[model samples]
Target chain A: MKQQYGIKDIAKMLNISVSTVSRALRDAYDVNPETRKKVLELTEKLNFKPNKNAAALASGSTKNIGVVIPFITNYYFSTVISGIQEEAYKQGYNIILFVTNDDLDREKTLLRNIATTSLDGLLISISSNSDTQDHFEQLMEEGVPMVFFDRVPHHIHVSKIMQSDFDGAFMATSHLIDNGYKKIAHIAGPKELNFTQERMNGYLAALENANLPRNDDYIIFSGFSQANGYTDTVTLLSLPEKPDAIFAVNDRKAVGSIQALKANHVQVGLEFGVIGFTNDPIATVIEPNLTTVEEPAFEIGKQSCSLLIKHIKNKNHEPHDILLPGKLVIRQSVKLSQDS
Target chain B: MKQQYGIKDIAKMLNISVSTVSRALRDAYDVNPETRKKVLELTEKLNFKPNKNAAALASGSTKNIGVVIPFITNYYFSTVISGIQEEAYKQGYNIILFVTNDDLDREKTLLRNIATTSLDGLLISISSNSDTQDHFEQLMEEGVPMVFFDRVPHHIHVSKIMQSDFDGAFMATSHLIDNGYKKIAHIAGPKELNFTQERMNGYLAALENANLPRNDDYIIFSGFSQANGYTDTVTLLSLPEKPDAIFAVNDRKAVGSIQALKANHVQVGLEFGVIGFTNDPIATVIEPNLTTVEEPAFEIGKQSCSLLIKHIKNKNHEPHDILLPGKLVIRQSVKLSQDS
Candidate 1:
């Protein structure tokens, strides 16, 4: 094992005082430029990097942003984290991560136990069913700046960033209708989520615009998973008057819908068109590549971080809602044209 | 916004002294059980949680672990992180994530800039081509407990937990040979990675045991991406005598190989065979399915974090290598019998 070197070693090697080396390492303005350069060169040569905690203890800012999320195994959350990481790296900040596993109790306990003083700010995507606002409001009053993204809570005056869930859902349903599918169904997420209601509204609006009567049994609100999609699609197929198209909440669910349809001997693209949101990488992996509305996950992550940093630097900065638009990626999963 | 509640407020509400409340919160032996119960009850009622920074600063234990990884955008890495997160949560520890984006310079910078004092331990999965040992050695010498997971460096005395890459490779190659494939080729990852060499050796060992002459041209060292797999398979097809089967390092490349084979009008499961490592979710999505070795990615992650915590709690603990075995998942990509 190699011996650990200390700050004094750099000072002694450079024939300078320990205070000068410390100040130079901290990039304090009082240190002379020549002295700082010499100390820095020696430190670099010796392969001794400074301890950040010590500096943070001296100065209140820890240069860390805590990110709270429900899950990371999925494509959307993971991609958003990549964007957040990229932005944090560029800004010389680190991120502390907390995963609530989409449990309300876990989320509440985690937020309550968060070490506010250790983090400069927080970026969070709340659980699907979280309804308590006391913990969040308490942290805000303590002057901890935060930004919420994707699964953001409603009516929280904090800066929030998310995809255009309603618009994307509208475009997807419209695409299905334009191709001549009058009977359409939506596989939606939990009924409590903001995006769930937003997407459902969009789907309903599109059907109304097309002068098609809405069927209450056609829309199914459930979990956002492939198995859920499969079961929902199966139920839809067994209906007296089956829907001819499906607009899923996410790609995984869409993949499930396609698989269910295929299993039932229904031609997906030609006979029963299907479309989804969030063009996850799996869109291509599925047979007859899925057409999807691609969520701007990375941009949402980057922009949220940028906005959080702004709030951290200026606590009085007003919170704003930023919604990024999603693009439709046409593939074979959806019918290009319908012929009866 | 709500008013900030502190220990003093809890003490006042309970008609107790601030020191007694602090002592009770820390579970000090001198505090009476009833007093402690009262203090905790009041704190819970007032929604007052201990500030982590103050506790950490006073006791010099942050109750946090730093996890430095290459990327979180893929299946293996993200699943591994989920395992780690589960363990960390159970242990009442928070994790700070640092992504190097698989760049050597960025990895070095992240390591150098890590705040050792802010974390009780570290769990790392190094970049593919990280050769220099100085940075890792320096951190070890500083008495920081660390555990390396998959993609660990050689010659590091630190605790390491990874899947049995050599054995997995042996199983994959031998399965192909047993399936009546006399000629086989391999698509490998970067030459510098330790696992790459181990896997290559396993493939060679299997070939040698069968008394089959090894063809130097059969082993192609490239990247781990699907594109690389496609190009490598294309190159193999153009050979004067193409191998009857292909074994890839990971599932992504296996998917690419299957796609390429199909594009060239080669029957994968019957006339030709394909096997891969890491039973990624995409393995099932690929046509004809992929029969491959399933890496214990989540187990590796969980064990690494557990081992690191042990080291953190006991500085004098001895470090040893732990390897988890992988299983062969049977799918249709490889021929089931040699009836032909």
Candidate 2:
């Protein structure tokens, strides 16, 4: 094993005072330029970095941002994290992650136990059924800078970033309508989430614009998973008058819908139609290549991190709401009016 | 916003002294059990938690573990993280995440700049082509406890946890041989990765046992992506004598090989056969479900975290090398001998 070296080692190797090496390492104004260069060269050659916690204690800034999300195994959230990591790397920050697994109790527990002094700020995406904002409000009251993204709280006046869920849902529904599908259905997420309500409203507005009669049986609210989609589609197929098209909240659900339809010998593109949000890689892998509205997941991550850093640097930074648009990716899953 | 509550607030509400409340929070022996019960109840009701940084200053344990990974977008890596998260949560430890994006330079920078004092230990899966371990060696020598997983270093004596790559590869190749495929090709990963070498060896051993000639033209080394699989398959097809079967290193490449075979009008399950490693979710989504080996990714993560925690708790703990076995999942991609 190699011997551990410290600032004292650097000073001894260069035959300089310990204070001079420390000052040079921090690029202090009083240190000579030549000494600073020498210190930097030696540290780099030895692959040595100054202790950040010591510096954090002195400066009262840990340079760590805590990210609270419901899940990380999914494509959308993972992509967003990549964006956040990119921005944090560029700005000299580290992220401490906490996963809630979409459980409100877990979310509450994690927030309650969080070590606020160890983090400069937080980036949170609340649970799907988070009914209370008491824990978050308490943290905010303590002057803990934070920003919310994607699955955010309803009334919190914090900087928030997310995709235009309503608009994307509207575009998806309209695409089906324009292709001559009068009877349409929606496989939605839980009723408590802000995006779920927004998407449902968008779907309703599309039907109203098309002057199509609304049917209560056509909308099914459930969890956000492929299995949920499969079961919901099965329920739709069991209807006396089955819907001709479906708009899913996310791609995994849409893929499930397609599978269910295929199992029942229903031609997906030609006979029935399906469209989804979040252009996950699975969208392309699924047969017929699902058409979807691509959420700006990575951009949301990058911007949220940037905004959180702003809050960290300037505690007085005003909270702002940013909505990114989603683009419609056309593939074989959605049939054209002419083809029909 | 609500008022931020603290230990003083709890004491004031309970009509107790500040030190008494602090002692109760830490479960000090001098504090009365009834007083401790009251403090715990009040803190839970208010969702109040002690400042961990201050506690860590006094106790010298940060209760944070840093996890360094290469990528998070894929299924296997994400699932592995889920396992780690589960264990960390159960142990009451928060995880700090760092992504290297499979770049050796990024890995070096992250390791060199890591805040060792802020973390109790580390769990790492080095980049695919990590050729040097000096940075890791320096940190280890500094008394930083760590455990390696999956893509670990070649010569490091650190505790490591990984799947049985060689055995899985042998099983996959032998499965094809048993199915009456005399000629087989292998689509492998980067030449420098440890698993790649182990898998190649397994494939060679299987071929030798079957009395099959090892054709150097049938083996291709490339990146681990579906595109690489497609291009590699295309190259194999261009050979004077194409192999009757193929064994891919992972599921994504296997999917690509299948797609390429379809594009070339090669009957996948009849005229040829294909097998892959890693039972990613996409295995079922592809037309003829992928039959491959299931790497114990989640188990690896859980065990690695557990081992690291042991190292953190006991500085004199002996290093361990744990190898997990993989299971072969039968599906349509690999045809039966009679069908072939």
Candidate 3:
């Protein structure tokens, strides 16, 4: 009636696919820069602004971001959420939470029923048990902007941010080796997680650098918990050639290892050395303060949220892979010198 | 159009107020039972159903609940959230989270800008610094259902749930006295919080029952943190007459007190004794393992969520006050006996 035009009309005039015009309108990175420039120029000349699309893109319109995580009752995750919340609050956005309790089925179900209309974007940390990318792929196809942090799927081509697990593990293993521990054991997380695999590879690389033999029995892959660490340590202790030191996937597991070693009347700092990833508060509380790699959890959360907002605003934003480094925190858990 | 009778018509026919008819339709607890029955019978006979109103009352119409909390980084709050998430998930409700970081201004702003249209109800634990109930009252006036948990306002007539702080504190102090610790000191939370007052009262009641002196010098009120506990303990130690035992409001403070006492070369389990509330995991990790009263954090969260759902479904549901009991958990922090 009033010479109103749609993206379809723009596509016809430019001799391009409707999707290409739509992507161009949203300033998607995949769209050719020259083509996007032309599309914007033509739209500005024709005053081709769709009311509903304009309103949807307005600042703070549905100013909410959904965060899907595995658990909230742990130090690492809760601290990460704090960082995300701080960033989101500063940017005038609200966070809606969905917890999967590390169960894949619940993660799938939660993702399936997420109300995309109410959320501007999503920040997800895939569950440890998640083995498929189909659920996330479907959401992306429906035009829901998302970024994954920490535990993430392997194949999805989206923004992902996490701590440098491989580098941290290498540092942890090298620290143990430097402390004069002859044979070292590793308590790892679930075998399926790529981070765990990366950590294992780091541990392997460190052992190879030091010209140590690879003992499959010394590496135990299990769940991420103190109990897992305790059981894994007990299994190591029962071996014919017990390891003199242990490197845990996290501080909780390291604490468990300490408890198990202490229970067996072994001197934690003297007879055996222990190193952990994630310098959790429990590291200080444990009898012998734990030596660990401090993950850049807060930075990961902030950057992931910021990257997600970019995607939400510009639909064609290029995917990014960010890996923040971790520092080794020296403490009493590992022996300081061979003489001591 | 067929003569569709609204709630106003039903109220006129029954010679009752429109508000009364509306409350009766929703099975409100405050209305007279006989009046509600009469209104229901009349509505049934006349087939009086308002489409929009009925649709608003339908199950799962807005299957989202907002959870406003002070902090998610602590063990107590995180455990409570786990319970809330479990209950809400079971009821097919998604949770939207708001963290105030225990700041009153942030809490007020969060409450003021909360989009009621997106949430069916709210589950809140006000910040430690919040000194007013006006924001909550305004939300109630808008007919939004809500339930307060843990840290709640004093006068609001809303469904509130918390632990039996007084009883737990009394038990902790009494345990100290029974073990022959004289000159017991209490390190507490913010004086403005009712729970902290209740805990202080419990400590006083125990001292009175034991014929011990009521010394204001022995009580210190401060923030709830390990740092607070450490500073308070340092202050206590500097007094001309030092305490023989310390009863902390929470385990974090207790751990700090232990650290301070240990630093001062005081034997925690021998020359001095320490007891704490909220048997946090840190309680076990602290040297000489802390003795404490375990708060029913999970139960409080589950019950608060369940109660909020009741308020959401039935607008007339009565406000409730629930206090779950805590029990004494004995460990090595306190001396076992006077002879020892």
Question: Which of the numbered candidates is closest to the native, going by highest lDDT?
Answer: 2
Error of 1 at A92 (Å): 1.3
Sort all candidates by DockQ, best to worst: 2, 1, 3
Q: Which stretch of 10 consecutive residues in model 3 chain B shows the poorest summed lDDT?
A: B51-60
Cα lDDT for residue A34, candidate 2:
90
In candidate 1, what are the lDDT values of residues B1-340, reduced to their tens digit?
A: 2337877788888888988987676555688999998986777677677666666666678889999999998999999999999888777688899998988988887886676778898999999879988889988988889999999989988899989999999999999988888899999999999999999999999999898889978999999999999999999999999999998999999999999999999998999999999998888777788999999888888888888889988999999799999999999999977452
lDDT of 3 by residue, B51-151 (tens): 32133334224567899999998999999998998888777677888999999988876775565655789999999878988888977876789999989
TM-scores of the models, in the given order? Answer: 0.91, 0.91, 0.83
The parts of candidate 1 lying over 4 Å away from their true place are A1-40, A45-49, A338-340, B1-40, B338-340
Give the DockQ (C-alpha) for candidate 2.
0.50
DockQ each: 0.50, 0.50, 0.20
Root-mean-square deviation per candidate: 4.3, 4.4, 12.4
Off by over 4 Å in 2: A1-39, A44-48, B1-39, B44-48, B338-340
How would you encode candidate 2's per-residue C-alpha lDDT over A190-302 as one tens digit per residue? 99999999999999999999999899999999999999999999999999999999999999999999999999999999999999999998888898889999999999999
Backbone clash pairs for candidate 3 read A28-A316, A29-A316, B28-B316
What's the TM-score, to 2 decimals, of chain B in model 1? 0.90
In model 1, what lDDT does residue B258 have?
Answer: 94
